[model samples]
Target: MSKRGWIIYNGNLYTKKFAEQIKWLRKTAETFDFEIDVIANNQLLVAMEEGCARILTEKQKPDFVFFWDKDLFLARQLEEQGVRLFNPAKAIEICDDKALTYLQLANHGIRMPKTIIAPKVFVSLEDDSHLGQVIEILSFPMVIKETFGSFGEQVYLIKNEQQLRQKAKELQHKPHLFQEYIASSYGRDVRLNVVGDRVVAAMLRKSDQDFRANVTAGGKMYRYQPTEEEEKLAVRCSQIVGADFAGVDLLFGENDEPILCEINSNAHFKNIYDCTGVDITKDMMAFIKETITE
Candidate 1:
């Protein structure tokens, strides 16, 4: 069996660093006589359609496909055609949906922050069946999050009762989640980078006066050691979510219990590298190569 793979990415492949990853993978793959292809979205759906169709017809197709969010429709179409996806479509879907992640984690006894889901078009506060539950379990200064939010951009802090109600009123047509703000995270959270079943590295992110510690939000990160519990949680989440390499976000609760925030299906490695000096891409690619060569 020849070792071969493909990487799906956006037009950002124009950057040298992006190409380096593909180049490195290809070189490493050649040791096993593997062929690798990198497809970018610059030419629209051409790469997706051609790639997906070829894999179905060609006997010598890419053994593994690593994806980084160019288009979901394209991704799904390829998977439906039986292309071997790195993180299966189902796993990506679970990680993308906050409500689903919570449900899965809770079912498996993984501790996570308190989360509440409201329909996109929530008409009124009193019209919620789960409103009572939120009121009972969540207190003021809670966090209102958009389920599909990324880079900590769509997170809002509802500092007072009025702000929560006001934002809720404005978002009558949009879906959202209400999570108990563990004021303890205090604009800081732990992100554990997991590669396959092992944790490559971990870091603690701190935001300024804000509750969200995402690096994009003027936040700083420091080195961190994943506690046994955190490491287990990271591995469990990676296995369950099917992420080859990802960052698992967690924070300490009032009781010092680890509460999961969310898991990144396609995490940003630059931040992790700047903080921890770990080159996660090399390890991520190594796993697939080793598996294919084996």
Candidate 2:
């Protein structure tokens, strides 16, 4: 019998890019003789009775799940039922929250920008005195990021105290962080796609218009070769986050050293594929097959 599995994605996001990603994975699985069924996260219902939790779905359960969504609740419930998730719930949870990602990386002595997580606040900020300390440490022209964001949507580069105060007030109620901006890597970054213990593909993203080099933000991608140090750092960061596969973004330090940017648990591989001509889904399926067989 052929191995059976599922590719779970978010139902709410109706976009062509997401659909294409699923298509790539499903097509790759076919070559390995693995039967894959694609399902949306919202399609499955979770039920808990007497402290026992289970997933209620019309579709039959598979031997494994390629969890491509960040629905932590559903992911954990699936794990509880003894279903193996590709990146696992814990890995997704950590990568979903920027503060948690930084904490995990810091604990492991990973090199990254100096970051200070904002305190949890309700409603609005009653006092802005803490901003004084944040300025003293990070100074002017700092980077502010929401703990929960993707595609560089919630990231900002504040040039002065006025903008900082304004952005802080706007995001006071939400989880956010302040960080030292790496001027050396302004408008540029390298994204390495890591599968298991190695980097399968890499691309340099650059934007002349904005500080963020995300492709969604109109950045251009170029095929580039990573140094040995850059490759090692990307792989190590993926391992630290407990991700089976991830897109590891690295920033260039003052002397061209690689600094950790962020890790995407369910990284979209189409852009990397377009730039590098490497189909990451193949590597992902191969890794999954080896893991399941082992």
Q: Please report the candidate that would top TM-score against the real structure.
A: 2
Alpha-carbon lDDT, every model: 0.74, 0.93
**Whole-model lDDT for model 2 versus the true structure?**
0.93
Query: What TM-score would you give candidate 2 relative to the actual structure?
Result: 0.98
Question: Would you list the clashing residue pairs of candidate 1?
Answer: 3-34, 120-174, 120-175
TM-score of each: 0.83, 0.98
Write one digit per residue (lDDT tens) for candidate 1, span 1-294.
565677777775457765665565556556655567776644335234644442233334457777765366666766766667766666777787777778777778788777888765634455545555666778887888877778898789887767877777777656678998888888889999888899998999998867788888878899998789889988898787777777899888887678888988877677778788987777777777776557
Model 2: per-residue Cα lDDT over 204-263, one tens digit each: 999999889999998999999999999999999999989999999999999999999999
Error of 1 at 210 (Å): 1.4
Residue 232: error of model 1 in Å? 0.5
